[model samples]
Structure formats: structure tokens, C-alpha cells
Target: MATPATTAATSAVSVRLDALIAQRLAARALVLAASRKVAADSSGIKTSRFRGRGVDYVESRAYQPGDDIRSMDWRVTARTGRPHTKVFQEERERSVLFVLDHNPSMQFGTRVRFKSVQAARAAALIAWSAVRGGDRVGAVGFGGGVTGEVRPAGGPRGALRCLRSFVEWDALARATQTASPLSEALERTRRLARPGSLVIVATDGFCADAAAQAPLTRLATHCDIKVLMLTDALELAAPPRGRYTFAIGGERRRFEFGDGAHDGAWVEAFRRRRATFVDAARKLGIAVLPVDTRDELARSLALLGLALAARRGAA
Candidate 1:
């Protein structure tokens, strides 16, 4: 049984909209590297153009030996009776929209903070990064049969408005009993996100069925999609065999785990569900980042930033 002080502490760290908002400055610093590529691209372009990398058309020129034959300018080549290739420039100012899930499943966490809080922190970091990078920032926060959307806009004002929505929607998530399908929220996002935008989804992988995946696939057709799966250690593996009591909705519930078989099954189920969602997302050409609740949100997001930078470098 947990002592009163321990219970109070747990409750305190559950989810606080104000606390999340207060950490914005620290979060901004942590994700600085993640958006550096976007900032660089927005400022200027490199002399070398990479073909088949979703760049904007620049001009047509005589084909070079090393140029991709597939990019040959058919009309230009026909008119000049010589091979020509298309040149493209990297785009400036990509839009970044966050799709945050604040459902009941994300409201539970046994460690430092609830998954919902971590998701909000991650969203804030990304929002600030987009602002610094000169990309438009926006978000759709959904759960408990409600959805809050912030239109994409540039600079700090846009970032702050998105952060405010995160806080409000997270609070509503805790109080409502109705479940919001992840697919519906994703469809809404797909409708709002423009082509060439980057969509980041922060969720607990709940309700990730074919319906949910369909919208993401549609969104990916014209936008860069990334999924941040938030999870806790307990979800990955069960605790040691023992009887434990948990406080749920102000009521104490006792659960006994004397045998490891049941616990193993539970862990396996979780693993399978996560694997399914990850595999599906990858198939759709979406990047997946798993954020554990035990890890500090700042460090995890920084690492994610580094990964994004590497991906851009490769591109």
C-alpha cells in the first residue's frame, strides 16, 4: 500500500498543464539541433541539387554524365536534339503539424510523469523547434471525444498558441469518459496539412488499427509523416511476481501476480501491438520514434533531433 505522502506525490506528477507550459524554455533548447536542418534550408540552398529527393523544380540544363537518367527533361531534349536534365532547389519553410493523442491510455504512468505529460512536453519542443527553423507550426490535440486544432502559422506566436491548445486538450482528456478514435483525429489532420508539410504524431499506440493507418498513409502521400510512440517500462515488461494495490479513479484496486505466465502474456500482447503499428508506419514511409516514460523528455527529443538531422543529410 502507498502512503499518503507517496500517493500525493504520484498525483502531483500525473499531469499538470501549467507545469508543462512552464518548461517551454528548457524544451526549446533541447530540440535546437532537431530543427537546424529546416532552418538551414529555409535560409539558403546548396549549389548541388539532389534528384528524386522531392525538391522543387529550378531549371533544365544539358545533361551531365553523373546526372540521373530518369530525370531527363524529355521536352527539352526533344527540342534541342540533346540530352537535358531537370534541376531542382530545396524548398524553404516547411510546415510542421503535431497530432497529439491525449486519450485515457496516455494518462497512466508509473514513473516520473504520465505519458500524456511527456507527449505534451515533446510537442512543445517540436513546436519551438519549428518556430526557430522558420517553419509554420500547428497541431491537432484529440481525446475523449473532443479535438482542438491550431492553424499553422510562423514564429513564436504560433508555437505559443499550439502549446496552449496542448494544455487545454490534455486537461479535457482526463475528465471525459468518451473515447476518440485515433483514425478520426488523423483524418482531420490529413485534411488540414498541406502538401510538403511534416506531420508528427505523438501517441500511446492505442486504437492503431487499419482505419488509423489508412489516414496516415493518405497523409504520407503528400507530407512527411513521423510517429512518436510514448510508452512506459511497465507496458513492455511486467513487474516481479507480487500482489499490488493501485489507486484508480480514487478507488483502491488490488491485483495479484503470483505467476509469471499471465504477466508474460500481457507483455507479449503489448509488444505485438506496438510492433504492428511500427511496421505499418514504416511500410508507409513514415519515421517512428519510441519515447519511453522513464527517459527524460528533453534528452529523448534531442536524440530524435539528431536522427532527423541524419535523415536529412542522407536525403
Candidate 2:
């Protein structure tokens, strides 16, 4: 169980680095449980089905005429009285790169936690999962017209580096005035992610426009790309039909939704924007997970694991 201080730390708009690190054990537990479920549900399917060229050997089968001679299994061929060729699954040490967006828009939330904090927690969970699965982990955080990168490395070191950078970048984003386009960050990711790498982008839906889609589509060609769109409840649905006043950045703003027409328009606009983003991602063959501010991070990630398991089983 998390302490009040830990919960408060995690729930804050500017998350504490320690809170992110402390969630490692919980993240590991969630990942382990999810992996077991996937294995049990998939039966013969391998849990790590994300394609790669790793050193793990799967099996050997009778050699075909076109089989590579170098992959010949002399021992198996002799014992079976037939030409056999060794078959190895792609390497499991895949690189997991996180592209995190800490722009000003991510600072809002009306539920359990801020969108920015949720993004950080999600990124942390992913890093921990990748490290436990024997994959390299790294991150690229962009906000306030600046981008910070942590090169991919094996073990827990890379995950820790990414968490630290995330904490620092979140603070910088709040204080800095300049704005950086999410497309620029996607372009940077295109250069950083190698073929067969798993790229996870955690951001608000601000960058899901035409300009950003091109870079993401190109990156998805060779890399296994996933997008986690962090959103608050208010963004998805309008509040009760009533006038509301709020304070933003030390200024007061008023909104009128008492009128049915106004309320409907607000809801429709939000739905349209969300639909566009989802449709674009679908067209490019990318999987987009909607991470709501009200949901538990661990539970949400476990659901993602199951979705991936189902996809792999189908494949």
C-alpha cells in the first residue's frame, strides 16, 4: 500500500521523482501478473511476441531446400536421419523508447491525478516492465521548446535515468515560456528509434494533427509504435449544464454551459477531435491507448498487456 505522502506526491501536477521510483515494485508486480495471464490465455504462444532478432533459440525443424546452410543442425540431423536447420526467435533484448510530452496542456486534471503525473507514472511502469523483460529502456522528453534524451541502456540504470529526466523536464516545462511542437519530438524519435524497437509516446492529444501524423506514420514502418493519449474527464465530457468559473495560471476564466445548445456543442467538439486522432492512428496501423486521469495506472497498463497478448495470439 502506498502512504499518504506517496499518494500525494504522485497525485501532484509536478510529480516527485521519488514517488515514480517507489512505484517500481508495484509496477513489477503488475507486469508479472499480466504476463502470467497472457501466457495462460495464449497457451502455445510466447509471451514476448514483439518481433526482434535476439539470441534465444526456439526450435529446429527438417531443413528445406532453400534453408540456409549456416543454420544447419548437425546433431539433430544425425539423430533424426534428416537434414535439420536451427530456428531462433528474434533477440529479446528489444529497445523500449519512451517519447514523453510535458507541455503546458498536460498540467490539467479534474480527477484522481494530473494528466502530466499520470503520463509520468505510465512511462515509469513501461520502463520497469521493459527492464524486467530483458530489454533496454530509454526516453525522450520534450516541452518548453527543449528536448531531453536518455540513450537506451540495459538494466535498471536506463529506467532510473529516464525517471529522473522526466521529473526535471516536468519542472522545466512549468517554468519555461517557450512551446515545442510535438511533431519535432516525433521527428527526433524517428532518428533515435532503430528498427524493431518499441516506441511508446505518452502525451495529451494536442499533437495528433496532420503535421504530427506523418512522422509517427514513418516511425511505425520499422518500429513497434504505441501511443498513450493522456486525457482528463473534463476533456472527454462536459461538466453539468451550468456556468462555471475557474482559475488558470493566476487568472480567472468563466464558461457558460447552462444552455443546452452550448453544452451539446462542447461535447460534440471534444468527441470530434478525439475521433480524428483515433481515426488517424488507426489508418497508420498504430495502437493508441487512451489513458484517463481517473483510472489506475497499473490497471490500465495491465489491460494494455492483455490487448497485446490478444493481438499476438491472433497473429
Candidate 1 TM-score, true structure as reference: 0.75
Give Cα-based local distance difference scores for all models.
Answer: 0.76, 0.78
Model 2 stretches astray by more than 4 angstroms: 1-11, 42-89, 246-252, 306-315
Highest lDDT against the true fold, candidate = 2
Task: List where candidate 1 sits over 4 angstroms from the true fold.
Answer: 1-18, 31-91, 245-254, 307-315
Candidate 1: clashing pairs of residues? none
Superposed on all Cα atoms, the candidates' RMSDs to the truth, in angstroms, are 6.1, 7.2
